[model samples]
Target: MTEEVNNSAPDNSRRNFIKTTALAAAGFMIVPRHVLGGKGFLAPSDRLQVAGIGVGGKGESDLTGVFSSGKSDIAFLCDVDDRRAANSVKRFPQAKYYKDYREMLDKDAKNIDAVVISTPDHNHAMQAMAAMQLGKHVYVQKPLTHDIYEARALTEAAKKYKVVTQMGNQGASGEGVRKLQDWLDAGLIGKVHTVYCWTNRPVWPQGIQWPATGGNIPPELDWDLWLGSAPYKPYVEKLVPFNWRGWWDYGTGAIGDMGCHLVEPPFRILGLDTPVSVECSVGSVYVDEFKRGYFPESCPPSSHVIMTFEKTNKTKGNLQMHWMDGGIKPERPEELLPNESFGDNGTLFIGTKGKMLCDTYGANPRLLPLTKNASDRTRPKAKRVPGDVEGHYTQWAEAAIAGYGKIELSSPFEIAGPLTETLLIANLAIRGIDVQRPNANGKGVSYPGRDMKLLWDKQNLRVTNFDEVNQFVKREYRQGWSLGV
Candidate 1:
């Protein structure tokens, strides 16, 4: 959404505090709003009065982007952590604050035209669905849902509410990513046969030794609220503020954390739908040692998930998509020189005639043809694609303020829902009972693994494996917190 200053500042001191605290917290050089606010289209006169849920961590960044876009008023901020919410209170003193997003939505439903949700994976579907049900546009961070059923429910909710929506896969709007799509469309890399996407997540909270016996919950945080819809458990410090990434109940581990960014490009450009089968080859390490009482006796810390898409009548050919986590690397693409290596995180598309490699976040993609002569310095420079990765936030703000029709949404639910579904399948595969074995074609050759790879009936939004993975596709919600269909 566009970030335009509302000329009507109800509280000058409060506005100043927001600007100053945000600058200090960001630890970046600050520019005055007026000076930084160069002439650009302002948000519509009927700008959205926006509220931010989960206003810590990523939520702060999301807030700054929306405010800067000049299209919305930061009417309220919500977070499970009181300390984090205090920061928002310092900045937007005039805005209301709440510990529970449900309270904020209930109290300010009339005033909040839109909501930006930067909460944990488990909370996304419920929050976004609630906002949509109330007729508020939503901009939710990706992967859009913690599970597959929520993904479908969210897409339907967006349509039913007829609200403008955007998934926070900011990379989807990157100029470089779009260029990668164009290159594929232009046949720069012929008939992509397989794709390998990797990420260096768990960097902040990954691979921790499971928490030892429990301790008292910290007073500053409300451990119960933090638990939210996840099963109730005693508070643990490692699971809070940041460490949630490693846990199964509250987070999606490496796959859900980075897949939206690393895997989206290929999933989009390749027009991948439901996979014919899915399975994971997990690391031997048990997850219990890392965090206390988080993972059940079941679950692993790291895995290599192989998802195969049979040649649908519409697909050009059978395509194999492999996903790796925990600093794993794919077998080197043949096109790269013997010594070449991809970034710690990124996607590699192996085509029939060549290969295309790009950064983990879809920056600096290049086409490597099968034949590269030593004298090929004479080869023309690869075409350049311009982008403003920062512009995506602005794009969402503009769309929210302009009432949907006037502005284009970069990653609407139509695109993001399936993307999230595909990524979440990898999470399910990793937790599945069977470790997928590789077949003659190097595709996943395992049982229960195939159970998670349900045939996706896009038109009907149902899985063919109704008896197996369907239960995992969606989850049961705690009472009073359930998201309705």
Candidate 2:
């Protein structure tokens, strides 16, 4: 992170002035992409100039997807860890590499037309917002942001800035989702009332105390930059690269990791909006033989979250969606044969007339009762992405090149924001399970956030009944960093 940021920047005041000037110029001076050729038009030779933040692991694949579209030029690359970034750097040798995103944006905003972000959950909102503020189109990995407030902010920003946007829930563009939509629209499922989505996640550590001892920092890693916007703490072992998902400060736990893929089928088919209420029950860990472990900073190992969304035109009434992770699953649907394989990760939709099930990313969609697969359910009602799930990347890149409103997107921030909020709201309930308060006797502590359903004030972005959980809705960034909204 800091490895590539060693060159000293100008003094704080001058750096701020430069940043302000650069962003202002980038926003106002750059010609709007949509206006060129009067919407949905790009010259054949024109290619999107993309700057990739977090160009490693998922970031690598994401950029590759965009580049493979034959409509993008990978102009710049940024990552906190040099080791993680090596592959991307080698793949696009000409793309300038930087460890600090702010530096790249500040210096190269004019050179970048769009940005592809695949950073950790904690860094997603800030980086995406910075790019959007500079009038750069963005494709961000899902759950769109780490906090509900951040999601709401990014959603609004996408509109205000008038930049083309897409979330990295590639499943949204899959044929299975469109097929499910067609079935639901055709009255096959008959008003989905209850939806169950489950995944075997939290493959990383959770429900554990932070290590008391600090681990030696990797030479190629910059610990401070990796902690962007998060509160300062010494680097610990096995936390970088992937395990950050289990920590509340850096990740959004299992639901955040897989909820977008699993919950998406019912969400899109039913046209869901911000959930009105959410409740969750999480597995507990015992510190010893008696006392249950209370690691407030860590997400629970297992959780069952239920979110209640207001009725949409596609549904008969309000819909109740359940999300389970850490290997916990809902009761098997009775319609299936006992020997049928219930996927390890899948989504099940229960409606008034029947039921439907699909694996992760809405793949292998099938109507329950097993025999329903014999009938022709394929309806070309919903348009399919050219390459299905893999097309998600090119879809965004093309829409970005064609300009906003020129083409439809499967999961723009407008959709991803609320969808992400649903997950984060569930997390509020999960984290609420550990909120400490004085006991009735005023001596020991109690967990008041437990056992109560959290009511959401969607407009206000806060919990109505429980105030303690609201603290998580928006977090203060560490000094010298801002959402830049």
lDDT per model vs. reference? 0.72, 0.90
Q: Can you write out model 2's per-residue Cα lDDT over 417-468, one digit (the tens) per residue?
A: 9889988989999999999999888899988777898899988989999999
Q: List where candidate 1 sits over 4 angstroms from the true fold.
A: 1-43, 204-212, 286-299, 310-315, 338-341, 369-387, 434-468
Relative to the true structure, candidate 2 has a C-alpha RMSD (angstroms) of: 12.6
Best by lDDT: 2
Q: For candidate 2, which ten residues in a row score worst on lDDT?
A: 36-45
Q: Native-vs-model 1 lDDT?
A: 0.72
Residue 228 displacement (Å), model 2: 0.3
Clashing pairs for model 2 are: 1-80, 1-222
Off by over 4 Å in 2: 1-44
170-280 in candidate 1: lDDT tens per residue? Answer: 788776677677667666667888889887666755444556678787677777777777777677655667777677677787888888888888887787776666766
